[model samples]
Target: MTTDSGTRTPIRWGVLATGRIAESFASDLALVDGNELAAVGSRSPEAARTFAERFGGSRAHGSYEELAADPDVDVIYVATPHSRHLEDVMMCFEAGKAVLCEKALTMNLADAEKLVAEARSRGLFFAEAMWMRANPNIRRIAELSADGTLGTIGQVRAQLGFVGPAATARLWDPMLGASGLLDVGIYPLTFAHLILGEPVSITAGGTLSDQGIDVNGGATMTYASGAVASIAWTQVAHSDNRASVAGDVGLIEVPARFHHPTMFTHWHDDQLDTISEPVTGRGYAHEIEEVAACLRAGKTESALLPLDDTVAIMGQIETILDQLGVAAR
Candidate 1:
């Protein structure tokens, strides 16, 4: 972000996949001022070229490795599936590239830890792409909760669900590390974590598919502060995607699709206040901006989306799946 002549330099970004998430991130990347989608990479050459053409990338690589190795790309966004995150991100690190990888960090907690260790050992910039944490509204909620504005938080409730296509391999396939919990549940879980740290105990139950992936599930966690969190996620039906945090003095509610909320309401002292935060395109831009800021500051990790919390959440996901009897692959 510094300049010899006093003009800010754009951070050049490379996207490592051509999936829907990649396109969304690219769209938001364009919305930011000092960032550009410099390159795109996909296993299929045509896919890479087509994505670059649509997203305004100047270069397209036929493989993820090639993209990681591209000298012009300052940071690479690993947008591959959850199962491929560890491998893909490690490749980028080996190529001496900073990385912002899509969430679920990896298939399990161990792999997530491996990534953290590798990134730390190499002193490279790395972070999980948990866009929700970077949302202005979500960050505001966390601030209120942390600063005692919510007043002795005692409970948090959240749920996310949709009747997704049963035939969609990404939703039903175990090989792809697909599950309602990993795909959507992590949001509610993380919301709770941001308010109440790690839980002392977690009790969970849910339905599992014939393919051994979770179709629907919920958990109730008890924190050391005596706060309790209840969270649920499902791909089996359309459930209210809302979230609420309750404390002794007040309550805050995030409307449907809380993960990318633009506004939320708080109630206390017989007063209801609505707060609105301007979200950059689709809300992915905040995380992108966070990554760029971290790189410019020479920080290896994002404070908003820390690697330790990511690993802990992955552990929570693994424990929840085990309780649901989803039989890990």
Candidate 2:
């Protein structure tokens, strides 16, 4: 059911890319009841037209500038590569449009700070599309931890990795802000931050490509709470992509894609309890709904994925990058 405002209208959305991730998000947006695809934009006019036609958008623009300028677009989803997020988001901000940009928010903390400051000064809605934070299961995990069901989380272990076919693809290109740490490693790092808070000490070891990007990296985060998190990310190997949160009482294991898993299990003593919640589409609808809900309530940030948390996460990323001797372009 669609949550109704006084006017009972769906939030209008403009998609700002034609990549695979963009298409996945657009397909999920269709499943959301209170959101409408108003437009799509791409560097290639034909790609934009095709995407708009398939997604039922009212217009397709050959350039992001036009899409951002379209008055009918209530919010813009910047789905471009991390290297281009700053440029794309600034253009939308210039047009007085709200934005939900893909994660890792930007190539580095400086850009993230700039974007957040601009959004604050302009009083415009802006969010890093960390879809996992907006997920129901992750929220449940947070709640369980808060309620002491986890009995004080002692450690968090998470890993995300995939074998990339293109050594020169965006995932492997440093010039394009392609690295396992930012692209995939952030998942485990963010998950650790979410559960264990900021760590006091960080150590990272990784194999760097000729382009100076991390192909595989592992980090150990030691928090002030005495809790430890071992997180790893890679583009050269296939991992289970699972996560485990260990506490005094027991542990919670997320099967796969721990970031967006359908179900998780809690092992307490001799009992193994499972919680399952199926999501529709690709699970992107959850975040889309969150953005619409915030906009309708006239909030500049999401309660779930707050701006402060985003900044803190970016800071953690910076620390990790510095340790790895890698710099974002």
Candidate 3:
């Protein structure tokens, strides 16, 4: 099922939505080698046509089902909202297509697990589009932490937030499974987990919108290593969007918008070291490249963005939501 080393066929990609994120992904897709934007899908034929035309896509489908069934496409990127992820992804699985789904994976942990089960059973390649894990600098940070450069990490702090756009129903509508934690908090939570393992307990507090969705929140997670992480997310205000990991030996600081950082600083022995790495097209290209490589290698999952970690993050999000009394639909 794997391609020979000498084979160099480009991986054909179909996008399953025409929203803003899909546009960004399409734009980034061009920056990576060995991939093509082969097709696009939208509920409206006109919308699909517009996207395909703009992105140089060969085909435009009026519905997701058509895109899923496109024989030319080797993989489909599911860019739909959190609520539609399970349904949209399952459609791709049935059509025997590899999938790279947008993160949070789904609205809840149960749905995330179901997606994992389906993909594993079908022997299809799948990964959460947790682009941060694919980021070169973030990967380096993990390596430095693991290699004893930052020994015995004892704390991590990360936060991401922006004033939610009032006009966008996707961010304010509870029916869309809109919550700041799902939208912004997942980054900080994942960053914490990247440096430290899963936490033993989580204590959280937040504010809910009139529509009964979380608007702002913060959580403190305590791990078995006696390490603690403080993470925050919000849709009501602008946060610094910074992150850091502290250890007994040193500290590493990722600048604002740390989730997809291209550079960070390492502090040790009364000196500071700045680390920088190349990032392709807003950092999304790395994840795209990862999927293409997995398919070519005949792998069903990516070690960088493992499904178990994705599910665990979803569980953490669910617990935070529950404690904040944000009813799950």
Candidate 4:
């Protein structure tokens, strides 16, 4: 950011967790030229110290409280688990720091709304770190979609799946809001929402573990525009992780790992057009840039990832979980 006197300043960032995702985010934070990782916090001081030393945070706080209270930190990235997102977001708000929280923003729709409302009430900047929304290729696709590139998209399909270690507490433990639903299913849900808007009707089917966590699921969302988005996610199998949007006149296909694509293709009348926009540094830098841009412009919420949209996506997930009987523990 450029000050009135022509001095450039980097957004000073603080990270609220030292988990694997936290590390990836921090590593990418360094790639954005106008951002700086100045602080890190973890429940364990040793963990904080280790992450900060490795990730370029100048300060290491033994607790989230200390990190939140740090005056030098202009923004905080809450990379905690889905269950902890609301709490961590509020903590940063209470400390007067701008926040970029991980998604799905909270465990439920009501909680997601509560976080946004409180952040709004305090006149603080808040946004969910849905990185794909800020991806250049996705933004271009959205622009083209709105401009009738894929005229009247009647169908959309998206899927994300992986077979991580089965026993990971966050993946199966209901107490930690464990369900493949929130953990990875959110990608498909939010992707659908971005392309098709909120669903007028959501039909869901899934395989649920005896312990009450949904291991995998498929959802069909119908929009008032006569569009239907078919979404699939799983933790027990490896899926193609691709997405496609189709309409009467043409088709737009995002290749494997669509949510994190380097480019996308458009097909029409035997003609194909490809847009290539490679990702930078794990692709988290774009999201960090959004936070910085919003904060520098003094905006309370991001236009790309609106507060209402976050809650709406949460509501859709809530509905899916209800249908699958995958309530949290």
- Per-model lDDT: 0.93, 0.90, 0.93, 0.88
- True-structure RMSD, every candidate: 0.9, 2.0, 1.4, 1.3
Q: What lDDT is reached at residue 325 by model 4?
A: 81
lDDT digits (tens) for residues 1-329 of candidate 3: 22687668889999999999999999999988789999999999999999999999999999999999999999999999988999999999999999999977999999999999999999999999999999999999999988988888899999999998899998999878798999889999999988887999999999999889999999999999999999999999999999999999999999999999989999999999999999989889999988888898899999998999999989999999999999975
In TM-score terms, candidate 3 sits at 0.98
The CA-based lDDT of model 1 is what? Answer: 0.93
Backbone clashes per model, in order? 0, 0, 0, 0
Q: Which of candidates 3 and 4 reaches a greater lDDT? A: 3
Per-residue CA lDDT of model 1 for 36-148, tens digit only, reads: 99999999999999999999999999999999999999999999889899889999999999999998888888899999999999999999899999999999999988898
Ranking, lDDT, top scorer first: 3, 1, 2, 4
TM-scores of the candidates in the order shown: 0.98, 0.96, 0.98, 0.97
lDDT pick, better of 2 and 4: 2
Q: Give the CA lDDT, 0 to 100, for residue 148 in model 2.
A: 83
Q: Which sections of candidate 1 miss by over 4 Å?
A: none
- In terms of lDDT, the poorest run of 10 residues in model 2 is 1-10
